[model samples]
Target: MNFLQFFVWGAWLISLGGYMGRNLHFEGGQIGAIFATMGIASLIMPGLIGIIADKWINAERLLGICHLLGASFLFYASTLTGYDEMYWAMLLNLMVYMPTLSLANTVSYNALENNRFDIVKDFPPIRVWGTIGFICAMWAVDLTGFKHSSAQLYVSSISALFLGIYSFTLPKCPPAKSENKTLLSSFGLDALVLFKRRKMAIFFFFSMLLGAALQITNSYGDLFLSSFKEIPQYADSFGVKHSVILLSISQMSETLFILAIPFFLRRFGIKQVMLISMIAWVFRFGLFGVGNPGEGLPLLILSMIVYGMAFDFFNISGSLFVEMETTPQIRASAQGLFFMMTNGLGAIMGGYASGAVVDFFSKYAIVSGQSQLISRDWHSIWLIFAAYALTIAIFFTFAFNYKNGLKTVKEK
Candidate 1:
């Protein structure tokens, strides 16, 4: 269930930029706008569907419905040529697809609990397969030469359809009962009360901030590698020829890092683990800023390895934190809220901000008359991202407070 959930995403998420820029002739900002659809849907759909799963619908059923609908949209999107048409198609696609992320977790957790399994211990290994699925999709796309073509969308669409059908076969997860009957409560907006707590508020704030970094690499990392094809000396480089495969290293690293989360959380606590994640982001981007396909290939490989720590530490640990902190009645809603802050608002900020930065660097090169055909300064763009991550880490070190061990919260 988890594997196919991310396989659909992996097929197109990272490679779409290359296709958009190389084949569709999209500008940096337009590409960012396209990616922002996920953010927009993240902001709206997850919470709404989470509310449904919490009070009215079965999570597994909702997950199936969302994916089925998303598959249709993705299929239609594959046929689009115009930016406006593709944008709206993807927007609709994401609206249905984003919520399934939370729903999948809800279903999985409920199933695990029913089987008397420990989530913290068992879930990571199970979830690690999702990353493996992602890697498989990326490799499939690259090997088939679909990375720079619209074929990637078809790959995603088929996977979505498959997962949509498979979702209905999972164990049933009925809505949790809630006593209160109100409009806001029905929509699960009652979880908004989490903002009233100082600790929860601060954690969500940083979640949003750190979330901004989540998609930056996905948005441009492949494009960055493929851009080397324009340079004479590096035109034939393996990194340029198989950019999607190269970037899949990060996903491979994620599989490993996901397994390390339990130890990190127990030993260092959430704060330190997250702090380490933030610092790792600095290296993730810093290495990209200086690395190339030749002698600097090692730096790029290192960056990909570090990406595991940077991503898993915050995302997995944060999800576990939400699970351990919130009441069972609001558990799904709280998880949706975490997704909203990170992938929703944070993603929007990162998309536009990073796009603007890319455009600015490109404009600078044109203004300086370096060459009309010269591409944007990727080195500067990556360094700026590294600096942003560093600043967030420094502030997060002092701003969020928690102890050095996992504090148990009794499940209701």
Candidate 2:
């Protein structure tokens, strides 16, 4: 159920930008705003929800209820037309969905630890299935042609509905308050103090910057590939018709690359690993700037392959770094802080900014009665994003300095 929950998101998240642009006729800024809701909701609501689940409610029950509510909102969202209506519904849905990510992890880790499983060895295989689930959902959407239809929303809703009900069947996870009498310490906010450390501060700041880049492409890449449908010869091309499936190559690569993280980080150190991530982002965006979905499909494929390094290198390695460096007492809170900087503030800003940039590129297409036309300068917009990623790479290469060393803690 946990894996399927994220699978539904992976299926459509990257492709929706394209659908909105090519099929729904939304403005760029508006589309970005829709994606921004995820970050916005995560920023404000997840912690509060965590508090409720920890203190007063059964975590499993809360998880199930949240998903039921989220599924309904998503179903309602599919019925709406226009950016305004869609944005409101998505914001509501995200509020319900965002916290589940954390809750699911909590439930899984608690279950594994309680059962005395060898988490380090066993958990990787279990987690890898989540990637499999994501790939399966993406393939389903592409195969069914739901990537261009409102039915994709239904796919996610139905999955959420199933998971919501099934969550109740999981081993009971009671409120932690019964074990710990310290109510004041349960609030989980004190880790915010980590911002005081200079290195941690820099690490987190860059995290937000990179986080901004994370969803921008997801928001627009499919749309870019689909835009080729406008070119007559490429309209029925396989790449255009099955862009979501092709893009799943990135997720597949992600599965392989995550395994390489320990080796790469051990060999190169955090600074270089992060630098590679930034450089890969440059290529990831630049490939889209120059390639077409038809003859240039190889470039797109290469871009997807590199996506593993670009995404996993920084995010997973960075998290491990935080885990290694933080004091144990505040570790959980610090992790939340890390997420806040990256996925919360960074995502919200990135989502909105990417939209604005896309809209800027499409400025030539003034609103006609019912449709928007493409600008001759479409490629220019992609190049601009590529340039931004490159600039970040250059700055990171020079500005950050950390010794190259893999410091792994041996398991007992």
Candidate 3:
């Protein structure tokens, strides 16, 4: 079930940018806007859904129904031809799907705690399968040639449908009683109380900044590579021809990097770990700006290599820091709020902003016979993103007050 949970996302997340640009021929900004729909939905709905699942419904049942609804919306999205239609469909799909991310974590934690499992020891092996499932789905899309089609949506939708059904069979998690029946508690916004801590406040603010970078590459990198088809030499290149396979390197790196998190967090501490992530982002965007699929493929490959550290370092370590630093009673809510800042508000801002940048750069290009833009200043766009990362890194170093630069972890 965990495998399929991520399988649905892996089938489509990275390739959707290419599909929107290459297949639907939508404006880059509009495509970013479409991706932003997920963030926007996440910002609004996850807390509310969490409240519902906590108060009145079973987590497993709620999980099932959410997937069912999400599947229907995803299938509906695949049928749409334009950005306007797709935007609404995707928004509905994400509203249902976003909460599942948190819900899945909740379900897993609940089950592990109930069974008295050593989550720190056992969960990693099981969670590794989620990465395997993600890789499998990416490979499936590449092999089946669905990476650039509406069929990717169908693939994801079908997976979600099956997972939804499977979730019903998981251990039952029932609603909890609450003494306070106020609006905040009902909506699961009580987690907002964490903002009272200065350290957490700074941590969450940067999380939003980093989250802004998360979807930028996902929303445009494929289209960026595919855009090279405008140039004759790269038009038939293997990397261009098999963009999905090439893109899979990012996910591949993610899997490996996830395994290294505990060590890195222990050795370097959260500040340094997050700093490495910030530095990696500069390469992530700079490589995209400078590399092509042909002669520059090495740089492209390196960019994908850095993606693991760039992504996993910040997300996993940040979550762990939150888990360790915050009190146990509000850990779930703290995590939820962390997600809202990063994936929710930050993602929405990034998607829309990146789209605008891509669209702006695209306008200067001259399109020839094939849908390729000639000699456009894409380097500037990448450099701008690199600058953004650098700026964020600088601010974080100076502003986020962590006294000890490193900490050693004693494994139990």
The residue-level lDDT of candidate 3 at 142 comes to 79
Q: Backbone clashes per model, in order?
A: 0, 1, 1
Number of the predicted model whose lDDT against the real structure is largest = 1
Deviation (Å) of 290 in candidate 3: 1.3
For model 3, give the 10-residue run with minimal summed lDDT: 403-412
Q: What TM-score does each of the candidates earn?
A: 0.88, 0.94, 0.91
Pairs of colliding residues, candidate 1:
none
**lDDT string, candidate 3, 1-412, tens digits:** 6799889888888899889887877777888999998789877888788778877898889999999998999899999887789989988988998888768877888899899999888887878788888888988887898988999999999999999999999998887666334556444367678778888788989999999999988888777887788889999997887887898899889988988887887677888999999999999999988899889999999999999999999998888778777676677667777888889889998988888777677753435523443344678888888999999999999989885533532231
Candidate 2 whole-model C-alpha lDDT, 0 to 1 = 0.81
Per-residue alpha-carbon lDDT of model 1 for 1-412, expressed as tens digits? 9889989999999999888877776767878888988899887776678777878888999999999998999999999978899999999999998888878888999999999999988997888778888899999999999999889999999999999998889999998885454445444466788999888899999999999899989988998998888888888888888888999999888878877888887778778888999999999999999999877889999999999999989998898788887888787668767877898889998888888887777742233532232468999999999999999999888888776467443322
Candidate 2 lDDT by residue in tens digits, 160-211:
8888999999878888885542332333357767778877777888889888
Please report, in order, the local distance difference test score of every candidate based on alpha carbons. 0.86, 0.81, 0.84
Mark the 10 consecutive residues where model 2 has the least summed lDDT.
179-188
Better of 1 and 2 by TM-score: 2
Instruction: Give the lDDT of residue 364 in candidate 3.
Output: 35
